[model samples]
Target: MPANLHAILSASSAERWLNCTAAPRYEEQFPETTSEYAEEGRLTHSICELKVLKKFTTAINQRTYTNRLNKLKKDTRYAEEMERTSDIYLEHLTEKAMGYDAPPLVNAEVKVDLTDYIPEGFGTCDCVMIGGDTLDITDYKHGKGVPVSAVNNPQMRLYALGALIKYEPFYGGMIKNVRTTIIQPRAMSEDDRITSETLSVAELKAWGESIKPIAQKAYSGFGEFKSGEHCRFCRGRAQCRARSETYTALEDFKDALLPTPENLAQVEQDGQDGIPTPAVLTNAEIGDLLTRGKSILAWYNDLENYALGAVLKGEDIPGWKAVAGRSNRTFTDQDAALASVIASGYDEALVYERKPKTLTALESLMGKKEFAEKIGAFIIKPPGKPTLAPASDKREPYNTATADFTGVTQEVLF
Candidate 1:
């Protein structure tokens, strides 16, 4: 298998390395491993590109599109959910393209070269559309675990900069603004599924200028090692000395002021006397503790994984040992087991229960257009329960008073 290669200053990790400038060099020691999730993302991206190309270009034949999709089906990760999500991505692009007065120039899998800002910097753009004075860059995100926003996103801005550089000669003076969009159909909240940010040409150019030095410093491995939430995806996170020192320092600080049972008792006694307890942390101190708590948790998880790996390899890790985890019993041969069960006594109907195909599966089997035309009216989506999210989330805040309770009724027992 070929090794998955990454650019030294790739747009995807701009958020990480830009913040923790020394992470790239630190991460260089570890080999890159492609997870099943990464492969699924690759497959979904390919599907999205092919679908977009088919819709935009007249030269592509139906057979070509079918062949591409058929090949994707061979991947174990391929599923109806992927097709549905990719369709939503394509729909977003199509809608954006249609809004233009003239037919927009839509390109998929666009190669963006960003050497001007970072050394040998380059990345592939999912979709790019240009018409009149506006350029739209849309990125398809397959992962639904975390919601991504386009506002001040380094990756998207870097893409916009590269796109600007690539098309400036052709669309100079005509392209005034760049719109960067992230389409994550699997996002939990409907509003969070699609988010956009628009930046003027002047703003993009200024941002490019600001990051030029930072990129150069990062390339030369001559920058400070600052740890933050960006460390979540860093390969060096487990062993990075800077990150270790950061967590260790914070832990020491926390230990000094952390409330204990004794301190709580003293605090309660002080409160009874109507005196403020000095043991309580200030607002700033509490905030700092909370921030460090997240880093500590992440570091602990990394340490646990490292220890587990060490133990598995017969390496001694002082206080830890690997052991067999719980496993559930399963039939060795499901088909034979089912057959034996049927022959003995159990009815086939009792053994297996039939279930209808999911909406996404049905749509994938039948063409999305035909499925919508025929069964669209049968679909009804109820409002989802409200959940807490960051203020930055695009979702509107749920209003308790405005919620419908028509179906709910009160009951009384005699």
Candidate 2:
């Protein structure tokens, strides 16, 4: 899924629906700037799942449960404000956070794959508590503030789809009364939010139909490339010509005009009450005009960080306090751990080296090693000066291939 222009710009659900349907192009586009910790949250989710599934199937607690309230608290390298929300999820999973129909769990594996058609897609959900036919799919949101509902969450719906497919053979009946839920760990905050929604059978079928063309197009050719907001996650973000031009066009026309809502009548005897004003403009000028009217904080870019630096000890000379930065501890250092191992009193060397450094090193690594994983350039199909790299090539990621590409279907992830 590298820089194939078609893959880069066309990955969004909206983009998929828009390209096939008669939906008119919006003058504006959204770019999904997914965060680093969001990526880490995904990784942690995978790790947690490995542990949970191992435990669920083997009926033994494999992963050592730690006193650390959250994962990052136990392992400090990944802690940033970006990870604070993930920590919240950890707390929720470990039963340190709050209320749950069942004890809070982390990375509780739930999957959904719309396999009814070709190029079928599947997503593993973050967490959930099984409650009969009502399977609550709680996707972790590392963003700050109150948890948002997973209601109508595409990922959750997809998870439900996967669950249905999985359970059909085992449960053998219609898999009636399946439901989903989303759990946000943090208490209500200005920035942290979680939302959930349930999907009707009609809705899921409709969604399947809606995404059919996108999957098909992704499989068939890189042609029909278009640009819009969702391209923020595009691996070719820095150099996508279509994305650049689309954003540039929107910015250029930012001051065009907007159709404003007009007030119908004047204020009555009420002193404070006033009549609403009606002004009209297009999407362009509306931004400027609306900026002057109210103090609506649509995007809270500032809530990106929360951790404050602790006092620096003996290291700093000026305007600094004498204290160590907030840090974490490990169970390996505990006398109790040593005593427990001694009590079991078996081979000390094997017990001591149970978790070798190499194993932990691999666990701590970032990203997949595949070269073909890089963000690729976006372009239309029937590639012109196309990079001739093999589809299975793992040397470079995305469309980062040095070979020049022309529009072609092979450029995308089928």
Candidate 3:
């Protein structure tokens, strides 16, 4: 097999590259790195692939499957969670396959090419299914930090387009509709685990045409620099000049509001504390500030991290130096320390604090179905605290009246 080389305009990073066309070239300065989370996700994907091959196709025999699975389980990073989550993923695939009137064509770990639209663009689709007229492309997201939506998701749509191109010759262009799905089994809530969106073949092709120019610009390293939430995963996000300028735009707002001498003189004294206070910001100003303020904290943290990393590497940064951060003390040998405490006339139970497993932990320990069946009635989800979000946020607005009535008593009056 040929070595897997990432495309400059790969489908996975399409969102970032499409939005900030200059990101792909800028990110080349940073070295590639992987985290434990990424390693675990890779292992999980391997497991899912093996399960799909064994169940959906005749690619592997029983003995081979068992041997491969056991070897994977022996890896240090492997955990029972991987097995349980992969099982759920397999069940989902089984159900999807069964839903078709006839057994649909299923494939796992499919490599699709998109050179026609994007220059050398390619990606690995986790699962692909083709029934009579619909082609389904499903991606397994192992991370649990955020829920991914399939609606107008660029990555998934790109993958769908690539899959269509790859299967065109075999299917003779019989595919009419395309379905893109994201499965995040470890999501915080069960309802959010799966999300799917369907588009007709014409629509998917139209979207591909829409991005062809952007893709060419991105591939040629001749695109404009833009920044937004898409910068989160870019390798050079911390050092990107466009991002720095975007966040620092907040500095201009201060000049917009200048306290005139007359307004300063009109400053009112607090009746209770007798402290002079400047004129309060208008509601419109507050809204404007909030719009810019949303990204300031994240940008500040990224800048601080970049500076600290540079300083640690012997680079001199004016007014900034790396110092040892505070850390908590821990017993070098916890078991030995606990034993010593027990021998010093202290009860062994006092040295340890007992607590029940959290609902999430319990659900992981026992499978989700078993946990629900055993103690479903005991579980409850209280209303979440009110949080500020932009108008584009999907969640419904919180009701102040309902919030005030919660945990408070109301007396009936005649």
Candidate 4:
């Protein structure tokens, strides 16, 4: 309900909003806007605009609701909006905003559920012009960061999927003949900066299908990756097993470190300067060591409040956060314990732990030096897929009608 909040509304949601049809199997417990990609802004804006135009006696666009503008960069502002919906909302509000309003409920969160597996995939466009073949889907973004292009954005594509899914059922399979774009209202200080791009029905479908596998994999790995970045804002982050690793990484490094500024500086300098290997350590090895530590630290920092916290009244408060990490916190008392064991005449070999085999040894196991030049040393593995994608442009293709700005865009073909 507030502006600048990053609610996760996705394509599945867009489909449900426009159709005015909530799915029977669909049970959304959180606020309607809590979805990863939501479409509520459009609904709110549409209603506000309608009220302003219909009430001739109303001197002010008595928009009863307000929204908190988005704070993050690359929120829904882009070019195409100026070409279409900008005029519509502006005319409706007939107002100049001071800051963002949070109470005004709208269909701003629009997503195309390319994956039919999710029920919210079925969606209606934000605004529809009646008595014509033209269909325009308008979306609003409140964030303050750089406006990302709606073209090739998965969020927009998912919204597209929802549009097609909802519209095609009644209009028949041909869901084409249109333009799509992001309309950033504040960008130009006039209307929205619109990205004038067109998407074929076929292309939209293809893009939607392309992302289905990715979504499926995430759903599958939800358990394994539950604790890391996923846990940061996850609805179920508190009890996830994957998040447990985040805790482990954090705990391992939360040592009461004795800061050795000089020692650390020398080690880091040696690594960067590429000092030759001495009997003790080499610069190259130092760099590698630093990198490994960074990697481990990153994994450890993935844990949120549970692993990193600053308490006031023995309770955690929002905003004032803390950082913690995982590092090998060896028990110093171990030397004393070891000495007692030696006193008992235990073999030194019994005290030693087995070390993991070096990667070079694994390579040697896979290849023989006899024909090492000709044999493959090791099989390569690709890195994992990235987690996040950009926000979507919530626009559908429509012929640029220099038509009456006063004309309606939503038409009931039915």
The candidate that achieves the highest lDDT relative to the unseen native structure: 3
lDDT of all predictions, in order shown?
Answer: 0.83, 0.44, 0.84, 0.41
Write down the RMSD of all candidates, one decimal each: 5.2, 22.9, 5.8, 27.6
Tens digits of per-residue lDDT for model 2, 265-365 = 23332333543333544444565545522211211111111111122223333453544559887685677887687788667676665653442133234
Q: Is candidate 1 or candidate 4 better by lDDT?
A: 1
What's the residue-level lDDT of 361 in candidate 2?
Answer: 34
C-alpha-based local distance difference test score of model 4 = 0.41
Q: Candidate 4 — number of clashing residue pairs? A: 71
Model 2 misses residue 16 by how many Å? 7.0
Model 4 spans > 4 angstroms off: 1-9, 12-124, 128-135, 146-148, 169-174, 187-193, 220-414
Q: Candidates 1 and 3: which is better by lDDT?
A: 3
Q: Name the 10 consecutive residues with the lowest summed lDDT in model 3.
A: 268-277
lDDT score for residue 123 of model 1: 80
On residues 1-414, what C-alpha lDDT tens digit does candidate 4 reach at each position? Answer: 123223223452322222212221122332232432223344334443443333322333434322221221134532333223435344332321212242221233233333373322333344322112323344445322445455545545565556566566766644454344455544522223554345777776676666555444433422123222222333333334444554455544423232245556776876755323334544544554554464345444544434353352355655655445478868779989888897899988898777866544543444334335553444322222323221232433333352322133322211
Sorted on TM-score, best first, the list reads 3, 1, 2, 4
lDDT of 3 by residue, 1-414 (tens): 124586787788888988988888888889877889999999999999999999999999999999999999998999988987888888888888999899999999999888878887788899999998899998888989777778879999989988998897789868999999888999875656888999999999999999999998987888889998888778888988899887777668675454544454555322233223356875555776787777777788888988998999999889998989999999899999899999999996798999998886788788778999999987655446888878776667878877666535332211
- Residue range 1-414, candidate 1, lDDT tens digits: 113347787899999888988887778888887788889999999999899999997747899889978998888888878878888898888888889999999999888888888887898789999997998899999888888888889999999988888888988699999999999988876677899999999998899899888888887887789988898888877877888888777547645355545556887867754323464576555665666576689898998887898789999999889989999999999999999999999999998889999886787788778999999987756556877543545667876654554223211211
RMSD of 1: 5.2
